[model samples]
Target: MAKHIIAVGAIYIDTILTLPHFPAEDEKLRASKYVRRRGGNCGNAFEVLQQLVEDDIKLHLISVFPNRASADYAFIRDSFKVSVDLSLSIHRDNSQVASSCYVFKSQETDSRTIVNYTELKDMQCHEFIDAVCKLSPAQDAFEGWFHFEGRTPDTLVECVKELRLIPQYSGFKISVELENPSRVGLELVAAEADAVFFSRAWAEARGFKSAVECLKQNMAATKEHALLCCTWGAAGASAVQKDGGEGIWCSVPAWKPELENQSVVDTVGAGDTFIAGMLCGHCCQTSCWSLEQKLKYATDLAGRKVYEEGFAELS
Candidate 1:
């Protein structure tokens, strides 16, 4: 049986500029490298998982893109066709694809600054449910998993409710990436997710001292069986499983740069890649591995992602 996975979000056209150092506010600077590619939390994760797996699983993506007639949409379609199953995406006429410009400074501590613009509308709950319902006979019969970027919480809740109502989808696992803690309605969405992922920054901004603390505070709002995980860039990753009985907290050290086989160049999409690696582990070894071992595998895989330039390089 082939495992089916779907990632839902908006895809972006990314313009990455690498510089030796960040320029002063009033000064001009030259970029040492420039590249453009398709990126988004879901898209990046899907691409990484696609490259990591062989032919056993089917990777699917449900994203919004400009109409096929648009040059930007054509470019993205052509570029990612070999990497994911985008047949489930939503396209709108006269729509412009979301775009982001990132400036990466290579001096001192490597950091990235991003500015994004979007004209695309958010994905609606019914539209997503409808797309999944319309899957072909073959795809419809397979057991699957869903991963969504946390956006529009109410819509996600409604979508999850609809999915659960389907008799054949009872075994489906739903994971959500809490991309931004500041984003409204996180509590509502987290309560419904089978698994929830967060970032250290998102946790800190909410006045929690650590990811475990943040998750524990919010775990009160989640279902009894919900599991929460958080990723700290250099510090490490942590996970707590709340099974309605007892909660177990576990943490794993992040992969250090000194242990990598390749040279570090870009840190872009590393976190997304981490989500991919974790999801890969979840899909492959759901019952066998301990949470600590899974975290180590994910962190190590993400450590290698930093050595590359873009998500596509994983192939």
Candidate 2:
């Protein structure tokens, strides 16, 4: 049977400005370059996954967007280079598209500062359930993978609970990303997920010094069969799989660019790229791969992303 991977999150149109340096208070500066692209946690991940997966595995995006007739909606819809099932997406009438503005300072370690604006309402638990119901059918027997961005923790918890109640979704594997540390009740959502992806910023915010330290302390909150991964920027990444009341840990070093003295280009969607790589390794592989392989594949893909401006040529 074929497999299905669905990602649920907000979609944004990103406006990126590359400047020589960040401006000080009341200072004016000219940007060196301007670029616009489709961006979001789920949107970026699906982009990379589209290139990594074969034709057998289908990709789907569950997001909120403006009216179908709007130009913003058209741009987003036409941006995907590969087939991504957006039938499950929700459209809001008389609403503006969610957008983000990023300022990349070339003089300061290739850092970026972002400001976001959105007038569209977030998808509620009922809406999520409705989309899943429309996608699931009695006669279809494809394996399902549901990934949540963990943006709205309360709604996510309810959605997960409702999914568990549906008999048709019993065989589905669910994953959740815990990217924000300040989001209260995210741990509850993580506890319900079969796989959880943690960010380096989240670990430091929670007072954990290392990726392994964070995973080890949080292992008790997950299911016995749960898999946990944490990505540390320059330090590489690590994973801990819970099995038989024990945690199996694996770590891999960060991948550096092959070109000598090549500065990092862009770090905008690196985390999303890493998530897509891990998902690709798990979903597209014919046989089960070791933890080391999974980490390396994801880390290397993300490393490559940093050398380019966008996700176009990462695969």
Candidate 3:
């Protein structure tokens, strides 16, 4: 049987407004066009992975959103390519889904400013624990690799601890994205995660000149069984693994899309797409392959994702 993969995080309804140029302070500007779509880190990751993996592995999503037979639910249900357990999703009568308005001012550079309208109530520690526990039946514990956004430190840590208590899940791999590594109480979460992904800026902010150095400097946080990966926009990606009681570091250059006559339309959710590719590669590829090979394949997928506007067009 193929290994099961689950991703948990927030999902948002995105409203993108394309402007001719950035507006000055107190200045009014007209938008060239606008679009609405499903977004969020895990949301995009799930969408893209569905297209890439097909039936090679089982994909599942756990998230919090407004529950109802509304547009939000309809959009997600239609876009999701796998079975979803939305019982954990909080619901409000006639509630609006969590939405974001992004102003893309690409007249100069590919940049966007987001204004978020959060509606999904933050899950409490007990609520999160209950939701995770409900995923597995009484007869058997859920057995799969879990990837989640590291947003709520207290709840996330508690969830990890509770899941580890299951005898069958003792060896389960849990990966977390360090989207905001600088946040308080995240070090504890990072130490517990089996895999940690860092943005290039996050690594440099910690006084490391490169991703490999960043991983080496934080070896204490990463246990002997853990691995770390960092993505540099055009510079490519690098990884560090704890294998055979030694630290192995590998760097791979970014795939060149420009050479292929492709222009980058937008960079939104590119990192999430890369993560999705890595997850697919991990479950589908043989373990005999080196970490370097895996990173190269993921980087190539990310490069291609940039050529399109959103993950929906990955196919």
**lDDT digits (tens) for residues 97-196 of candidate 2:** 5555454556565678777788888999999989988888866655768999979899999999999888877888899999978788899999999999
Superposed Cα RMSD, model 1: 2.4
- The number of residue pairs in model 3 that clash at the backbone is 0
- What candidate 2 gets wrong by more than 4 Å, as runs, is none
The model with the greatest TM-score is: 2
Q: Candidate 1: which stretches are off by over 4 Å?
A: 81-83, 96-98, 104-109, 136-140, 258-264, 312-315
Per-residue lDDT tens digits for candidate 1, residues 110-148, read 777777777777788888877887664434556768888
Please report the TM-score between candidate 2 and the true structure: 0.96
**What are the lDDT scores of the predictions, listed in order?**
0.78, 0.88, 0.74
Task: Give the lDDT ranking, best first.
Answer: 2, 1, 3
> What is the alpha-carbon lDDT of model 3 when measured against the actual structure?
0.74
| Pairwise lDDT winner, candidates 1 and 3 | 1
Write down the RMSD of all candidates, one decimal each: 2.4, 1.4, 2.3
Residue 114 local lDDT, model 3: 68
Tell me the lDDT of model 1 at 50.
79
